[model samples]
Target: MRVKVDADKCEGHNRCCALAPELFDVDDYGTATALNDGNVPPELEEKAKLAVQNCPEYAIEFVKD
Candidate 1:
C-alpha cells in the first residue's frame, strides 16, 4: 500500500504526524508530509490507517498496488 497526502485538502493540522510520527513529517508551518514514501510497512499499517481516519481534511489516501 502507498499513501499520499492531498496538499490542497490539507489544512496543516499535523494530526497525521501526531498519530504516526514515523509515517509522517510535519513542518514548522504544520504541513504534513508522508515519510517512507508513504510505503506502509507491515508493522505500521494500523497506525497509518489511524492517521488517515483522524485527518480532519480527509486528505490522506491509500493506493493499493
Candidate 2:
C-alpha cells in the first residue's frame, strides 16, 4: 500500500509525522508530506494506517500500488 497527503486539505496538524516519521515529514510551517514520494514500505503499512486514522483533517489517503 502507498499513501498520499492532500495539500489542499491538510491543516498542518502534523499528526502523521508524529505517528509515522518513517513515512512522513513536517515542514517548517508544520505541513506534513509523505516521505519517499508517499511510498509505504511493507513494515510501515500499519503505521501509515494509524496515521490516516489520526489525521483530524482526513488529508491522508491510501493509494493502490
Candidate 3:
C-alpha cells in the first residue's frame, strides 16, 4: 500500500503526522506531506492506516501499489 496527501484538502491538522510520523511530515505552516513519496514499508502499514483514519480533514489516503 501507498499513502497520498491531498494538499488542497488538508487543513494542516497534523493528525497524520501525529499518528504516523514515520509516514508523514508537517511543514512550518502545518501542511502535511507523505514521507518517502508515500511509500509504506510492510512494518509501517498499520501506522499509515492509522494516520489516514485519524486525519479529521480526510486528506490522507491509501493507494494500492
**Model 3: which ten-residue window has the lowest total lDDT?**
56-65
The per-candidate count of clashes, in order, stands at 0, 0, 0
Q: Each prediction's Cα lDDT score?
A: 0.89, 0.93, 0.91
Q: Write the per-residue lDDT of candidate 1 for residues 1-65, one digit (tens) a residue.
A: 77899888989988899899989998787888888788988999899999999999999999777
Model 2: per-residue lDDT, tens digit, 13-55?
9899999999999888888889999999899989999999999
Better of 1 and 3 by lDDT: 3
Deviation (Å) of 19 in candidate 1: 0.6
Ranked candidates, highest TM-score first = 2, 3, 1
- Which wins on lDDT, candidate 1 or candidate 2? 2
Instruction: Report each candidate's C-alpha RMSD, comma-separated, in the order given.
Output: 0.9, 0.7, 0.7
The true-versus-predicted C-alpha distance at residue 65 of model 1, in Å, is 2.7
Error of 2 at 16 (Å): 0.3
Candidate achieving the largest lDDT: 2
Worst 10 residues of 1 by lDDT: 27-36
What residue pairs clash in candidate 2, if any at all?
none
lDDT of 3 by residue, 1-65 (tens): 89999999999988888888898999999999999999999999999989989888888888877
Q: Candidate 3 regions off by >4 Å?
A: none
